[model samples]
Target: MSTVEPAAPDATTPAPAPAAAPSAVEVRETQREASRRDEIAPWLVALEALRRKGEPEWLAAQRDDATARFARLGFPTTRDEAWRQTSVAALARTRFDNATRGALDDALESMPAFRFGGAFAGREAVFVNGRFMPELSSLGKLARVRVRPLRQVLADDPDALCGLIGAAADDDKHPFLALNLAAFQDGAVVEVPERYTVHGPIHLLFISTGGAASHPRVLIGLNRNSQATVVESYVSPRGAHSFCNAATEVLLGDGAVLDHVRLQAESEKAYHVATTATRVSRSATYRSHALTLGAALSRHDLGVRLEGEGADVELHGLFVSDDAQLHDTHSKLDHVAPHGTSREVYKGVLGGRARGVKNGLIVVRPGAQKTDAQQQSRNLLLSREALVHATPQLLIHADDVKCKHGATTGQIEDAPLFYLRSRGLDEEAARALLVWAFAADVVSKLKVAPVRESVERFLRERLPAAGAVPGTRA
Candidate 1:
C-alpha cells in the first residue's frame, strides 16, 4: 500500500538530467579583477616620462593631443558597442611607463629564433624591444624596393615622415593608437617603386624583451603596378611580462598587389595590442594573413579601407589559445568607393580555460555602388570550460551592393573524431588529428610553403598532448 502511494507522481520531484559543465566566465571575472589592480602605477610613470622627453615641437603637440584624447576616452569597457565582447579593464589596471632606452635584453635570448630557408633568406629586419638592431638585420636589396628603419626615413624625408605619422594612425578616439602616434621610438619604412615586382619575400622580426612597454610602428607604401610580400613576426621568451603597442600602415596604389602576413607568438605573461591599417587604391589587390599564438592577453585590430574604385582586399586570420590566455580580434572593412570588394575569414581554436573573442564589421558607403563584401568567423572549443564569442556585423548604405556576414561557435566534430578512432586511433590521436586538420586551412593559405611548415611545427609544439597525435611529425 505504501509503495503504491509513493508511486504517485510527486509534483516537487523530477528526474535529474545530465549536468552541464561550468564555463570560464568566473575565471575571466577573476582575471579582470587582477588586471585592474596591476595597471595604475605604470601609467602615471609613463605620462611623467613622456612629458619630460623634450622631443621636437611637433612631437610634443602630438603627445599633448594624445594625452588629451586619452583623458577624454579611456580604456573601453564591455558597455562600448565595438568592445562588447572584449574588455580592456585589465589593460587599464596597469599603465606601462615609456620604455627605457637600454641594452639588448638577455630575456630575448630564449625566444624562438627566426630561421629562413628560402625565398625569405635575403630580406630581413630585426627589432629588439622596439629598436632596430643593425647587427641582427640583414637583407639583399631588391630592384626598386627600399626598406629602411623609420628613423633613417625621418631623417632623409621629413615630409614623408609627417605624412606617414598621420596616415598610420588617424584615429583620435583610440588612446593606444594616438599614444603610438606620439611615442613610437623606432620603426620600419618600406617603399616599393612603381611597376616593380619583388620575387622574394621580406621578413621583419619584432622581439619584445624588456619589462617596460614599448610602441613599435611600420609604414609601407606601394606605387602603381608594384608587387611584394612582407612578413612580420612578434615573439618573446617564455613567461616574460611586458607590453607591446604596435601599429602598421600600408598603402597600395593602382594595380598594386601585396601579400602581408603577421605572426604573433609572444610570452605567456605579456600583453599585445596591435593595429594594421591599410588603404587600397584603384584596382589594387591586398591580401593579409594574421596568426596569434601567445600572450596572456592579446588583441589584434585590423582596419582596411577601400579608398578607390575597383580595389579588392582579402583578409584571413587564425588564433590559437590555451591555458589561461585571453585572445581578441576586432576587424573592420570599409567600402568607400564604387565597385570595390572585400572578404574576411577568421578562425579560432581554444582549449583549457582560455577565452576568445572575434568581432568583424563590414560597411558599404552610400556611393559605393556594386560593392561586394563577405565576412565569416568560426570558432572551435576543445574543452568544456573554454569560451568563445563570435560576432559578425554588416552596415550597408548602398542598396545595390551585395554583402553577407556569418559567425559560428562550436566544439570539435564528433563524426571526425569517431572516424579517426575507427581507424585504430586512440581518443587523443583522433582529437589531435582533427585539430591539425582544422588548422590546416589557414596554414595552407600561406604564400610560402616553408612558413606554412613552420607554423604547423609551432602548433604541434604548443598543442596539448591529447590534441597532438602520437608519432606525428609536423
Candidate 2:
C-alpha cells in the first residue's frame, strides 16, 4: 500500500490561517443575494439583471444609489422597530432566480379579477412580473391624463421623469423600497397636466407568476388644479411561492385632488411588500383606501408628507388575515406646513391563528400650527389564537394643533350574536353578517365600483372563519 505525503511548506512563505465559517447573518445576506447565470447576463439576480442603453444619467444614478443602499442595509429583521412584528426569514432564505418574464397569458387566463370591466375596462395597465405588456394593456388617451409606460417615457423624453420617479421613495430605511427602485423594469406613468381632470380611475394591475420575484413601480404626477383617481392592485397565483416588491410615488401639485386605492390580494404562499410615498401641495388632497387580504407574509409602508399649507390626507385601510397568515402595516403622516390636515382609520380582522400588526403616527412639525390630525385603529379577533398589535400615536411639535389617536381590539359582542341567532340565523351566518357589518364600511370607502364589488364578493365568500370556502380567495 502506498500513501501520498503532503508537500513540505517552503520556509520563505507564511502558512495561511484556516478559513472561518460565515455568521448566520452573513449566510442569510448571501442567500438573499444569490444569483444564477442566464441568457440575460452573468449576474442573474432579478435586481441586477436590469440594464438600459442611452438612459438618462439621473435615472441611472438613482438606480445605482438604490442598489448601493440595499447592499449596505440588507434586509430588515425582527429586531428592527418597524419590522418587529413581521419576519422576512423565509424570504431571505429562498433563492429567487428570475424576474418572471412578460409571457404570462396562460398563467392569467383563469384570473377573472385581472379582467377589467365597466369603468376600468379601457383604463387598465397590466404588468406581468415587472415588465409591461402592451398587448395586455390599454393606453388610449384620456381627457386630462396621459397613461404612458414609464420605460417608454424614459426612452423617449427622459426629462419628463427626472423628479417623478424617485422623488418621494428616497428612504434608505426601507430595503424593499430600495430594491424596487433599483430593479423595476417597466411600470405605468400617469401624467395629469395642469388644470385638467381625469373623469375615470386609472387601474394599474400587477400580476406575478410563480417561482420568481418582481419589482413593479408606479409614478403618478398630477399638476396644478388637476384631479385623477388611481387604483393599484397586486395579485398572483394561489399558494404559489413568489415575491412582489412594489413601490408607488405620487406627486400632487398645488390645488390637485387625487383619489388612490390599493388592493393586495396575492397568493397565500407569496411574500409581498409595498411602499407608497406621496407629497401633497397647497390645497391638494390625497385620499388612500388600502385593502390587504393575501400573502403568507405581507407588509405595507405608507408615508404621506403634507408639504404645503391647507394640504389634506385621508387614509383608510382594511386588512384580513387567516390561516396563520401575517399582515402588517406601518404608516406615517408628516405635517410639515401649517393648516395641514390628516385623518386615518385602519381596521383588521384576524382568524384561524392569524396575526395582524399596525404602527401608525401623525407627526406635526414645529411650524405646523392648526394641524388637525386624527387616527384610529380597530381590530377584531374571531378565534382565541388570532392576534393583533396596534399602535396609533400622535407626535406634536406644534402648540396649536389638534392631534389625537385611538385604538380598539376585541371580539364581536355576544348581544349582537344572540340577537342574530334569535332571528333564525345560523352561527356562521350570524358571524359573517357581523364581520361584514364591520368590514363593509371600509370597502365602501373605495371609489372604484369594480374593485369594491370584488372585495365585497371575497368577503361574502370567505368570511365567517368556520365557513370559509376552501380554494377561494382568502
Which candidate tops TM-score? 2
lDDT of each: 0.78, 0.82
- lDDT (10s digit) by residue, model 1, range 22-81: 346555755855554345335635665656453555656766777666545556677556
lDDT measured at residue 426 in model 1 versus the true structure, 0 to 100: 83
lDDT of 2 at 250: 94
Q: How do the residues 1-474 of candidate 2 rate in per-residue lDDT, one tens digit apiece?
A: 122111223325233335597666566645655521121122225456566667899988988898777776677767566788898867866776564543365446735656545457678888878778788777574655788878888888988888778798765678888888788888888889999988878888888888777888899999999999999989887766778889999999999999999989988998999999999999999999999989999999999999999999999999999999999998989898899989999999999999999989787878889999999999999899999999886767779999889999999999998998899888887888789878867987887887887788778767855353223324
lDDT of 2: 0.82
Q: Report how far off residue 100 is in candidate 2 (Å).
A: 3.3
